[model samples]
Target: MIAEMAHLDVVVPPEIVDNETSGETTVEEGNSVTLTCKARGYPMPVVSWRREDNLKIVLRDQGNKKVTVTEGDQLRLTRVKRSDMGPYLCIAKNGIPPSVSKRIMLRVNFAPVLEVPVHMIGSPLGKEVTVRCKVESSPRAVATWRKEPGEQMIISSHKYNVTEYKEGFYVTQMSLTIRNFTLEDAITYRCVASNSLGATASSVQVYEIQPQKTRTSTKNDGDDSRLGNQIPLAASDHDKNDLDDFYNELDDPINNYLDPYHPGGILDNDRDREPLLKDPDIPKSPTGSKTFPYLNGGGGEGAVGIGSRWWWWAWVVVVVFWSVVLPGRVAF
Candidate 1:
């Protein structure tokens, strides 16, 4: 039992750590990340770190680029970017067989960015034209089109359409379609892509191609000769006065024929019914004073005229009858 125990103790390795450092990590840009590599061994093994894919680990803070760390059990990264994401290897071996390693995945999330080229083209009327742009982002972005110098979004309709295509996991193509194109479709159109992080934009110009017109010209000297041979016209004072009178008649005529609601129109078409232009009902000669007589106290009766020398006896009888019948009214 002593010989077996000695052999077992002699065969034990100095570094015999298990693979307990494997994990997954996710971090945003401009933030810090810490990766822990812990292990246990017979002689307390030392830790060394390296990239699994044989790539450079860039330290943007200290200007240390393409570096390899051969020490430290903890791997720290500050201001992590999207390009720093990959599998990391942590190996533990102190002259032992079957070496141990762990892969820690680090994910970096960022905002969307656009890299678009300017394109200008002329399209004919009643045709379809496409305005296309490209984008790159970690998370998928929502795309839209807006008319510039204005921020109002382009409302999709039968003549306008918006679409997107994914070229890769991080690259995409955003486009807009103008169907049955017209002159109004020519504008400075901008394509926008947005996500939780930020937004980016690009612009394209579309123009309407006007059709060329053909012209036919005729050259003839006879036309000028004919115009010269024609009599020269002259306006006399009488013609000018007639023209002025006609214009005045048109502006303020004696009657309005075209007006439907003219009060002067005789709808009955009878001269006796023209209320404004017809003769008045009053007589030319005045009536006798008998129509409304005045009292003559000298004769004790009402007379047709005060100039009359004689007062009729019938007038006295009428005054007595009226006074007796209507005592409440004054007889006149």
Candidate 2:
């Protein structure tokens, strides 16, 4: 072993082979897909896979258990789902100064799905209201608004405003606005979505709410009697005291001065007596007329008048004279 020293060991960073790896792939839902990543280095590079968004990878072969990283040069997905549609990253490293990564995009196609946020919407008459529906699909579905019962397509105009908003790569919000909503517009409307995969529809009901009616009450002659009867039900203590004072004043002898024929003297007969003052306990009618209590009845009907009591006493005296005094004279 005479002369020269030979070098055998070498180190190299990992580099992904572009021709052997997958960049972007599109497949239908429920189909199988495979992603391959090949890398080379002085020492054999270890290959691993992960999601570009750092989300977990679902392993269908391993009882659908989720994992952050999978060790393999080839990623196999059987029976792909829509949730598997996203960007994936393949990493290669073997104790190298810089690791290598390859981005692979996965797309899964599915049928159109329709969702109605509010199935029933109410708007006041001559007001504006909007009906909304959400759609999710790959390949960008075509959305349309159609009035039910006839399936007439809605066009963008002053009466009906149709609009679409993009919420995500595959999610869109569809809306139909009705200006000056009326009774005729209160019907079921359909939101239809169609794509190359499939077509779907959802319904929304629009209803017109009548404007609230305002009621006002006024004092009228026709309602005077009913209203007068209700006053006693709500009478307060102060009103009762005022009524008592009024009745006492009516009973005073000084009020007899108002009678021209019986001034300062007692009434000779009940027929000649009359009420000289209005009763204060009774309520006045809406027509500015006062109500009075009954004069001849008592014990719940009304208070008895002074003239009615006098009449009863005079009748008793006459009966006694006819039965006792005249009968005794004739017998003697």
Candidate 3:
């Protein structure tokens, strides 16, 4: 007898239900929003919610706990902000060979906000200057430059240039450049931003400032002569007289003071000069010993002292007399 085959159920892959699930949603800031995702599959598929960018999802209901993936068919957000605007993913899986996911975009609308980087700008005359402001809003804002007091609208022209740069989906950089800045351009300018939600404005003031000055240094002839005339501390009166004599000798060409063969030249004068040992300028000590003036620091005199040579001559004569007379006596 053959047993009957057990009943078997067919396995099925997960499929997202588009009609029963939420699609693209738009809400204002500080408001609450809900996204629902439903799916059908065998073995009951599990539904999960996550950000398309893989960023943590904020849960306001559970004390603002942030989580990467939340298990449910519904994703609820309270007091939504502009940062919460992006694509979200709803995934469905049941341990099947194929899983399914749906993309839902969230857009949060907000009023136009303006931020001025510099409130006051100073520029030199006849030069160009640029002033910039930052704008943040949803549904791109119409930005403009307006001069205060008169409320005159400024447009791109030869005298002024208006520019805009989109830094992000909700951030724009607005700039106004003034060519050949002059006194007329020195005034309070306002940056105005308006959108479908609201409008905002900020101000910038331009003023004329003096250009930086460069300094130069110069030397005077009198100052140079004064510095040259100042004498050194170690120079003595004798040194000054010698320097003067040298200059005088140079002026008198007839003297030929530097000539080696001349009668009155440096060589002849040095040869005829009295020796320091025999000179009477050196003073005698209390013991009758000749003392050197420069060595003792007692006098700033003509030259360094040389003691007497009488003792040297006496020794030479004594040796000669002893050798001659004693040798003669021994021979006799």
Best model number under lDDT:
3
> How well is each residue in 149-268 modelled by candidate 2, as lDDT tens digits?
999999999899999999855789999999998899999999999999999999999997777888565667549757777745446877989999998777554434333234544533
lDDT per residue for candidate 1 within 18-70, as digits (tens), equals: 35454787778789888888866555556777887677777666675568755
- The sequence of per-residue lDDT tens digits that candidate 3 reaches over residues 131-235 is 999999987899999998888999999999999999856889999999999999999999999999999999999999998788554577668778999985566
Query: How accurate locally, in lDDT, is each candidate?
Result: 0.67, 0.81, 0.83
For model 1, what is the alpha-carbon lDDT of residue 47?
Answer: 73
TM-score per model over all chains: 0.45, 0.60, 0.65
| Ordered list by TM-score, greatest first | 3, 2, 1
List the lowest-lDDT window of 10 residues for candidate 1. 283-292
RMSD of each: 23.5, 14.0, 12.2
Candidate 1 residue pairs in clash (backbone atoms < 3 Å):
none
Instruction: Find the candidate with the highest TM-score and give its number.
Output: 3
